[model samples]
Target: MRIFLYSLFLLFSIVSHADGERVNIASFSQNDINSWQTKIFSGETHYAFSTMDGRTALHANSTASASGLFRKVSIELSQTPILHWSWKVDNVLTGADERTRAGDDYPARVYVVFSGGAAFWRTRAISYVWSSKQAVNSHWRNPFTANSQMVAVQSGSERVGQWVDERRDVLADYRRIFGKEPGKLDAVAIMTDTDNTGASASAWYGDIWFGAK
Candidate 1:
C-alpha cells in the first residue's frame, strides 16, 4: 500500500482589491512561498524555484505522490473574475482516464476553492487540468467528490515541454456549473500529482492572478 500524508488546510490573510485592479494570488517568489503552505496526500511532491522563459516559476516534481501549495483569499468575483496563469508539463500520463479514482491524476492542475459558509456541505471547487486522454473543454465531477468539478482546459501532448498561458472567468464558470452565484473565492492552489497511477510527473507554474477585463 502507498503511504499518505495528511494535514490541516493552511489559511492565509484575505486580500481585498478595488475595482478593475489586478490581484496577484501567488507570486511564487522566495518571499511568497513563505506564506503559501503545502498539503500532502500519498507521499510528497518536491517543489522549488526555477527560471523559465526569463521568469521565475514554481517547479513541481512528483513520483507517485500528491501535494499542493495553496493560499487563501477573499475576492469579489463580480469585480475581478478573470483568472490568469501559465503552466507547462513534461508530458502526459499515458492511459490515465482522470474520471476514475485510479486514473485521477494530472501532469498539471490549478484549483479555485469556494467556501461552504454555515452549511459546509455547500462548498465547491473548479479544477482546471491538463488532461492526458480527455478532450479539451470537457468537464465532469471529480472522482473523489461531486462538489468539486474537473474541467479539461488543456489536453494531449500537442504542447508538451512548452509554456502555455490560460485565462478563465471564474464567475461565469461557477454559474454555469453550479447554477448559482458564487460566494467569496476562498483559496487558490497548484498541484502536479501522479499518486493514483503510481507514476511520475513534472510541471512548472508561472505567476497566478485575478483581474478584470
Candidate 2:
C-alpha cells in the first residue's frame, strides 16, 4: 500500500503549462488524453475514453485492482489554486471503511501532488475522494502514510449514477492539512481503485482544470 502511495507522487519529465488564467489538465471532452500516463499497482484498473451524458469523458472500471492516470505539470498555486472537475460513480463500494488499509478503496479520487525535490520523503499529496462511508467534508490521514491526506469531498449512494461538479482550492487545502506553505503543484492524477477491498467499482471523469478563484 505504501508503494502505491509512493508511485502516485513519482515525478516525471513531462511538464505542462497554463494559459492566461487557466491550466487545462485533462481534456477528456476533446477526446485528448495523450498528456497522461498510467501507473499500475496490484491488478490493472481499465481506463478508456467514453461518452457520458452527451459528452466525452474518461471511464474507469476497477475489479479488485489498483491503477491511475497521471499528468506531470507545474502550476503556481498563487495564481491558479482552484481545481475543477466532474465525476459520476456507478455505486459506492459495500462494506468499506476508508480509514483502514484493508478498506482503502475509493470509487473515484483526484489527487494533487506536491514535489519534495531532493528529499523525496517530504513529497505530499491531497486526495479528494468520493467516499463510501466517510462523511462529506471529513478528512483523515491515509492508512498507509500521513504524507497523503484523504478528504471526502463526496459521500454515499444518495447521488449515485449522477454527474457531480467539484471544485477545490488546492492551496487552502494544503495549508489546512499540512499547516505549512506548499511548493508549486507538481502533478495531478485520477483513480478508481478497489484492490484493497477486493470489490468492483466504476466511474466517469469529465475535464479537469485549474483556474484562479
C-alpha lDDT values of all predictions? 0.81, 0.88
Top-scoring candidate (TM-score): 2
Residue 181: error of model 1 in Å?
A: 1.0
lDDT of 2 by residue, 1-213 (tens): 355446745545648597958899989988899978888887999999999779789999999999988888998999999999999999898786779999999999999888787677888889999998788888899989889899999999999999999999999999988999999888899999999989999999999999997
lDDT, residue 72, candidate 1: 72
Model 1 misplaced stretches (Cα beyond 4 Å): 1-19, 29-31
Q: Estimate, for each residue in 1-213, the C-alpha lDDT of model 1 and write its tens digit.
A: 111111212243456544457988877643357557778787899999998777688999999999887777788898899999989999889876789999999989998888666555566789999999788878898888778888999999999999998999999999998899998898888889999999999998988889985
RMSD in Å for all candidates:
3.2, 1.3
User: lDDT of candidate 1?
Assistant: 0.81
- TM-score for each model: 0.91, 0.96
Top candidate on lDDT is: 2
- Candidate 2: stretches off by over 4 Å: 8-10
